[model samples]
Target chain A: MTTTGSLANGEADGTAGSAAPDKRGHRVTISDLARQLQISKASVSYALNGRAGVSDETRQRVLDLAEELGFHPNSAAVALSASRTRTIGIVIARDPTLISTEAFYMRTLVGIEQYLNEVDSSLLLRLTGENGEDLDVLRRWSRQGRVDGFVLFDEHQNDPRIPLLKELGVPCVVVSSNAPDDGVGRLISQPEETVTLLLDHLAELGHRDIAHVSGPFHFIHEQLRVQLLREHAAARGITVRHIEGNYRYDDGADHTRRLLTGPDRPTAVVLGNDLMAVAALRVTAELGIDVPGEVSILAWDDSPLCELAGPGITAVDQQTMERGRAAADLLLRLAGGQQQLHLEAPPGLLRIRTSSGPVI
Target chain B: MTTTGSLANGEADGTAGSAAPDKRGHRVTISDLARQLQISKASVSYALNGRAGVSDETRQRVLDLAEELGFHPNSAAVALSASRTRTIGIVIARDPTLISTEAFYMRTLVGIEQYLNEVDSSLLLRLTGENGEDLDVLRRWSRQGRVDGFVLFDEHQNDPRIPLLKELGVPCVVVSSNAPDDGVGRLISQPEETVTLLLDHLAELGHRDIAHVSGPFHFIHEQLRVQLLREHAAARGITVRHIEGNYRYDDGADHTRRLLTGPDRPTAVVLGNDLMAVAALRVTAELGIDVPGEVSILAWDDSPLCELAGPGITAVDQQTMERGRAAADLLLRLAGGQQQLHLEAPPGLLRIRTSSGPVI
Candidate 1:
């Protein structure tokens, strides 16, 4: 309550309190920290901001020196500089209702928040209706100097936001499997390796034919996944059939219904996400088809739902949270003036559960 | 490229660009809009901020007039006033991993974002390890004038943050079932009514004995829920047994296993959340018990998992997103200097799915 007095008096902890200039009659700055540590200013900034490039020991030394020097960032002065707000922006261009149900974005947000919190930075979250609205929001925040940088999500082919972000000259990192090689930093997943992992698991189970229920083809990841699946399955001497899904439960149920009831149903079915896989399982149960006995099922993304389902669905764990944290780290480094930051997200792991088994 | 020039000069759209002073020589302000519209300044502010307690017609009129007058809020001027940062803070004192797995927080966030986005405001999200860290964050944000207000979550009995918030003098709204009536705005659910609804549904199915798998008892809502459940069940000639859970999948499975194997197993078990409910369904399957035939199951909170489960769990829809939106609206109003705002969240609806049936 009314902590202004304590904050202004520089309480003993040396945690972000206002203080008078040091013995040299000058406020300690990042440059001073760099000079004292004999490292570049960028390194000192990275260490202080808890960025990825700095080693733990270097970060500890930087922290110790800053504390001894009574160095604390003056946010008001920073704001006046029009350089850094110590805040990052993330705009999700999707229906709020849809976003509420999906666990992917939420997990990503947790990762981003965890990193920013550790660095004593803040996140500015915005949800928009369309790509155009997203640009508008970004422009407004940039013009207002409300954020130091942004973390981009849901990259599309020739994403319009890419050009806009470049034009705005704002630092950003795009988290997607299909991010363009434009100057911006990108955190991408290995689509070919992911596809190979899924295919190898199914092929070893003696499944010669498989059907894939993919997410909407407009998404770069979905397109890459379908293409890679076909390429990988062919090399494994297995036949692959493709069906487009919108990553919804009904899409999975409807496609599975058509596949199971039609001529020559594939022995194994792979879906784009956990929801669809669960939906496919429900469809199997409704039709009295034994899962993994009649048809093996696999989900693209692993979540609690996969394990909770009866005869737990086999899934590829994408490490969504880690990807989020890495993306945030890249964005922070980019904001710190580092260039060409590209990070390959950790590979997806095939979680073998009861849903995938030897073909009967 | 650089938007500084355009942002410094008023454009045709009259949207947030800097503009010259009007004919009166002084810059157009909210007072002018209020005088023109013949409404209180607070009403005009509410309309502009898209907060509750303002009619749609009035909001439209305020927007139309503001556009005509080229009245765009200058964020720089606002920030300098130390009154409105146009940013709301939400500190979720929970494990990041746990936050990612639970759909509840995500849905609430979506709701909060929707409201804040409509008002051209931003959400500052922070995830802390514990209550003490949460307090530190609030104090820091408050001291720095980084946030205009906060939205409190997960209230506990004899909550410590209440006094601190009051002393900080920062406006906030607590979204909880057991928020204290200490002058702060509260968006609370009807716990008694919720308990009665759940009991009535189970009793109607001829279930005389039931077990309640509840969230952590330390939560004020959980305490109120269990107490209300027993009081309501006694009048309905039902016996209620309580099992403490941490709102995890394992809690539901472990409790259900214990109950099913022990003597005088309840005819029905009500879980605290969807994850727990799904876990219980798995337990019944492992034990070779027929759902709704040997024992009935129900869940407290409804989510996609409830419907995806094999039998489709019977659940109480808490309208979490609506609650979140309401809390945001209340907080915005409080930040605008309104006081004593209290709202009752919509009552939970009992969604009777395939999992519940008459006692066998």
Candidate 2:
């Protein structure tokens, strides 16, 4: 651990007064306490931080002096020597414009922030540029000891960050089902159950043919959902077709239009997210199609937009906030030097609304 | 300015080798470089940081040694003595659940993050609990030198944070017109012009009576908008009534129902936000009232939600992302010790859609 030599040596030699302010008249620092107590700064730090190596009498003296002097540990100085910043880093790589419209990320951030607040830690948020600067950021932060741990999101298949984080030996928790269990913490959700619930709802509505407008298949969860949807549909004797979407409103609308206008229109359509479902609803209105009568529509994620849409969209309640809280809990445990944790979030629930019904 | 005397003095006396690792075999630190160069760590820091005290020759030598040794400055160490963290703080003292649904804040965050990324800075985000911990956070962050500056949002009438920030002497930029300009930076939006434009559009549609469902009056912007709306309505020879709304869908719907079901129903309704406008649309539909045919509905802010709504509600485009970028720019300037800045964002544009039409 590197520290400023001149300040500590000069002060230790010259000062014995209790709570003597630095030359600049700044707040009392650990060095000030160390100088007054005529002991090494390391011992003072160890005592204040409740670390081993300091005698009980010395620790008590340090605490008593700290209280009397009104000493607030400098966060930066503590971070440098103690190697803990009390800050967690989250780096998001996505189009800045799209991030604003994503209700999922927003809710997840709230959950993460709520837990961090309770723990008295700060969140260091970074949005990576287009050139995949996320990896670079992780390396720099790790080398600089800028953050104690990281919470990773939007996990891709065989995510490159996993290997990099492992090499750095940084405590990390990934909110993904696909991440390899290589000692890093994992927060997994039951996509299989989610897909089955949606399919069951559609089958019960007597829909034999369905089109799934899914998020980019590059995402692990999307791939899992698609695979599960086909397996479940086959069991129910229902035919299903998959269309790729980027989880945006325009693509959802465009895909819906193409499907409804093509040679074979599915009796029911399931969209990847609430925004896409709202877009599909608009397209159906534009095409003069009667929802739930001529066709049925469902959304994979539930949000206020789905509930507020003209013909309220039937959706799967993913319990996004709860998932966020669970991820945070697992991350904090991992960061606190606990064993690598694996938490499975509860499966989604089907919310039936006006947009889905018996196929006429 | 406190440093570890033993590590530096011991290393400076013993080390003359080129790029010698510390005893722990950890990454190279500024102390390592200083020891190799046989100089004080402060000189090395000043040279590497390109500060004024270092000579040209020394600065070049420091730069060359840093490059050859692959030395990345420790952010925490630099923060301690140099007093610059390259991190900006933002504290939001609102309910976590409401934060997730608000698109305005989401867009603003994107804008702020975009600018910070370009400037190679991180955002330190904090959400205060119900006890108004925001002021405490600001004070602690300032005292700890955790952030170089702060970007404040959701300005309230006579906000207590203003005085606290000033007393702390921390660089700050407030994103509000109502903030008292006492040397802190300000990013003001033209609420008066925005109100005039919306009022003109409604007047052109022959709507003589208008009901304004505004955000909580405690917020300065909402107060300004309500005041402006009334002033502009009177000039346009229109009668206006104000209803308090919490900027949530539920309150917006309830307020709309009360206004529409009342005996003296206004021909036009102006909502505080896009979500509220969507709720008002739903309420009008539930009451069997035709939008634009009986009562015109307009939103104060335009988002994708507004465009996706049935009949596409008219709204005022507030340039939310741009406002966020501007606030970030101003905050960065203030943190850099530039002159205090006060920038006026362009007036919101009136976006006319099918929801506003001639009153029958």
Candidate 3:
């Protein structure tokens, strides 16, 4: 009973009634186990680790001894014996500052952490220069048995990490923006539906000439949105022009200024994200243009910031939290060696607000 | 030369001329080495790892063989022998979503990552619920020898993590806004001087009554900023009011709406951070107020969003990137068992922009 209680404490660490680890960084080495159980070091190691050395009764006794000592086996030590580290790796493919602005990544991370916590698995976060240079670290982790598996995000078409993940032969889940049936497990979100909803909403308001300021063309999600917008705009016979931005606040303001100064200024504008949408409002104010009355605006992502902005912008709710949870679930299943093929988050909702109205 | 070159590749993985890690996760084990070099596994292990059983000639031969084979000693294996994992831990204490909007944390992470990369170490990032619940992971990593040191941020006075670090006997650096002087390898930023400069700037512009929308009282930086604001306001014989916020956009909007509805609204307002300040502009616009004419506004922590906001907010540039780098440098020095410390970033500069002007 004390052994079970202590083992539970070791598993559910950081709570009351949990067995505190030895303050001296003392590990339950094979020798330590052998000394305690009055057995040979090799015998204890093989028995506890389920190797071919000792009897079933000896293995049970060794395991019981381990539990009594409150030793939660080191994942790395267990790796050599084909055991779980109870950890997941996530590589953020950008600078922390840029990544932080998109609540989607953070919310998704929270979801992953929540599910991993339930399984008593911790997360190992790594940063990359958007160039997949950290792929080697992931490889080393696999070889050295550092992490049991990984969850990847922000992959481009023909991603280098995809082949690497397969080559490493590790259980992994890739979070994607588009439908990537990449053989490996993945979670995808619908970008086309968001664009369609925006076009419909903007069309209902009698907007013919519209401008969409989008992020860089390389990002899969950005490209998908742009493609969808062009298709819908052509089908509906709406005159649509596009401007490109680097997904920054300044980019939004600069591109909007360029859009307005053009020979034919559009009656409505759709910016890439919340930061750009907010920047668009600043541009409209500087140019003495009345929002909705002169030019309506729709943001890509709806956050509290959108609502907090003056005359809250009409935007699509990406349901980032749910998307994040789905990705985590996919990884959890994959890490368990189960094949969960693909998942898609529900289509984004069009949040109509004060920023969009009938074009005058 | 070829042997040395191959060894360097194993050591400097991801760089040019480095041999790729085995796709199938092949760790060159002692057995593998013994079989290849025609020696006993025990002799190979002892000679390669500097354990007592092997002669000096055998050790050199083992080392040469290892280099020739491009063998990289696993970090986890080395860790068991009281070696570093070459990883540093950083625990973020906030909602990942809310934390993303503030550029401060990310800038600091970049700083930490940059330094860690230079030392051929990697970063291990973890998310916390702001309650230090993630301390278990930190403790486990220490006992398991997963990381060599830590870079801590948002530390409260007498932070619980400080005592925990001392108990773990791990090298760490605590980054604080105020002069910590906590003897825990702290890097301080100039909060008081920034507050003073702000007051002086506003006072010079003939602003008598000013309001500071401070963050929650629990945060040490917020407390220091509020104290210094009160001190300077009192010294200058100016009427100053303080409002509290959780430092979110909604908090900015809700608090500003409250400030405006109140009978005594200050002529100018200072927000805890850039987001709150940006939200204040939206609230002002909703109330049909003209910035720098009816009300002057100042935001703490300048990001590009500050410049992109309507009329632009006069903000204190926190030099966040440099601040972050300093914190990282401090942690690195500590990790190397060096006593070099007592780092402080240059004082924040109050960048005067369109948002602040002569009081109407």
DockQ of every predicted complex: 0.37, 0.33, 0.17
Error of 2 at A7 (Å): 47
Interface RMS for model 2: 7.8
Q: Per-residue CA lDDT of candidate 3, range B1-360, in tens?
A: 001111222134321221223444453444455667776554665665567767888888877866766654433223323435667777666766676566666565655554343233567766655545567667767887778777877766667877887899987777665665556776666677878889898888889998889888777887878888888788887888888888898899898888876888788989988889998888888898889898888898787667656577899988675566556555654665555445565568889999998887
Q: Which pairs, if any, clash in model 3?
A: none
Local accuracy by lDDT, each model: 0.76, 0.76, 0.68
- Report residue B201 deviation for candidate 2 (angstroms): 0.4
CAPRI category for model 1: acceptable
Compute the TM-score of each model's chain A versus the native chain A and list the values.
0.78, 0.76, 0.73
Which candidate, 2 or 3, would have the higher DockQ against the true structure?
2
In model 3, the number of clashes is 0
Clashing pairs in 1: none
Clashes per model (N, Cα, C within 3 A): 0, 3, 0
Off by over 4 Å in 1: A1-83, B1-83
